[model samples]
Target: MRVVTMLHVEGELDQSRHAAIEHAVARAAGEVAGLRRSHLGRHYPGTVGGGQYTWDVLFDGRDPAALRQAPALLELVEEGALRLDTVAFERQHLSVPEPGIRDCVKRTLLLRVLPDTPPEAVERFERDMLGMPRYIDAIRNWAFSRADPELHPTPWTHVWEQEYRELRGLQEDYMLSPYHWGLVDGWYDPESPQRIVDTNLAHVYCPAATTILGWEA
Candidate 1:
């Protein structure tokens, strides 16, 4: 299972403590049972629902032993130094496989689909999302999946993630794409009849020195 966690830091964490925090987290990652890979970094400029830092952990399975969070992270949360919003979802649809790029940007779209929306309409919305890469050449890789409520409950029902060569790929190619504005926009726009998603969403992206969303496992 792939666990994507976005944290809203309550205050400016002390610069002196930064290395300790990172080292603690890394140590925990190594000790954790099923954790295979992990990535932690500050989010980039273009963001919605607060800029926030992000943490991605890939687990071998849903075992309880593997799910334990780092002590440092728990301390921060317990001390009210950080706020968290996490989603655990399996990679369902993998379209546009990683283009073998080491330096890239990964963006995550976490949204809540209206519960009353017809299943057919929901399916159509998903199809529209998956079709975006076809029209936007800048998208290097992408993955879409429904969150597992049993594991972690949240208002967000789906996760749409994508990778790009740089911030421009998303700021320009993605935002300005005709298909994105013309067809896909309707599903999220309240004024449109096709609207099915709630306005509150977490659309954030950050720098990635190595593939996170593009990982095969």
Candidate 2:
């Protein structure tokens, strides 16, 4: 089981405080039970969502109740360093080729399931999306879950996360995968005129160096 927490920070960044914040987060990660790895970072240039920073924490496996009152986390909130925008599902992995996914290139999608869309359609979309890893060999990891907009400062209702070996694989292999174009594209295509999802808020991010087993030092 993998629990990912994405923290969207508010206010301007003080570059000097970055180290302090990260150190604090590391301390929190260590103190929290079931937390195996943690990564904190800001969006890359041109990334869609405007969050100044993101904290991706991977827990080994824990009940929601235990995670909710994590002491180090509460301390950060109490200290005013972070805000709660969205706390989506602790992702249940469907296809993970390996355990060291922290080093993979990651893409996070903030999905908006339309009001008029039928529940069955949403279910089918999720079913198809999860099936991608089976068809696209380049997709090393994939997970997603429904989101609660009220829990987030943003308007999205679903979050899609994926991992790949390289940027080119995201383009040449996964994008070109038959499962994507044949089944998934129509649900998001604007020209179709009845798109079920609003994809404007999605973005890609790589884990920072401080994250356990992340690509950086």
Candidate 3:
């Protein structure tokens, strides 16, 4: 299973606290033998609430056991900074599926557009584009919504993650569909959405091997 840890700081995090936190994180990484690959990044300016800093640490492991030991690693950070509000989840068990471990291509895209637009409309658009009958077939998973309240640093915006599977059969079926469009633009409306701010896309690769830690349900 893959695990994602979200840490939100209540106020401006001091430099001292930041250093200690990073140090502890590094130490924990060293201690966890089962970690296959880990990535840590801070949320961009528009992604968090006012006067707060958010960071996400992602761990890819073979099994739940590997993630079970994650808290111990986080405890090290807590001991070092003592100034953070943290939440964690075994990604596969959480609301959002763990794209890192699933056999699919993972993509995270940040979209900032007009506010007050119902989420249903956005979801509908995505479904229409990705669900088209005549298009290259790809095992795809998509969701759209406003950013988490605690994580929305800016007003009137949100982020989304999309997953596509590279299955030859699916791809062939998509090609025969009438809705097939050669380019991504055929699906996503960059301007119609309006109020554009920022956009980003990432292609994620899932490692073949993983380690399981002692995790309790």
Stretches off by above 4 angstroms in model 2 are 11-14, 31-36, 50-52, 58-81, 90-93, 100-102, 147-156, 176-182, 208-217
Going through the candidates in the order shown, the clash numbers are 0, 1, 21
Choose the strongest candidate by lDDT: 1
lDDT of 2 by residue, 1-217 (tens): 3434556555666776656666766676677777666666655555566355555655565453344356766766777777644444544444455546544566666778778789898888888877878888876666666764333334667777766776666768977987888888878987775468875665656543322223211
lDDT of each: 0.80, 0.62, 0.39
Give me the candidate number with maximum TM-score: 1
Whose lDDT is higher: candidate 1's or candidate 3's?
Answer: 1
lDDT of 1 by residue, 89-161 (tens): 7779876576576789988888999989999999999989989988898998888899887777667899988
Q: Which ranking of candidates, highest lDDT first? A: 1, 2, 3
TM-scores for all candidates? 0.91, 0.69, 0.36
For model 2, state the Cα shift of residue 160 in Å. Answer: 2.0
The per-prediction CA RMSD against the true structure, in angstroms, equals 2.1, 5.0, 10.7
Deviation from native of the Cα of residue 13 in model 3, angstroms: 0.6
TM-score between candidate 3 and the true structure: 0.36
| 112 Cα displacement, candidate 3 (Å) | 18
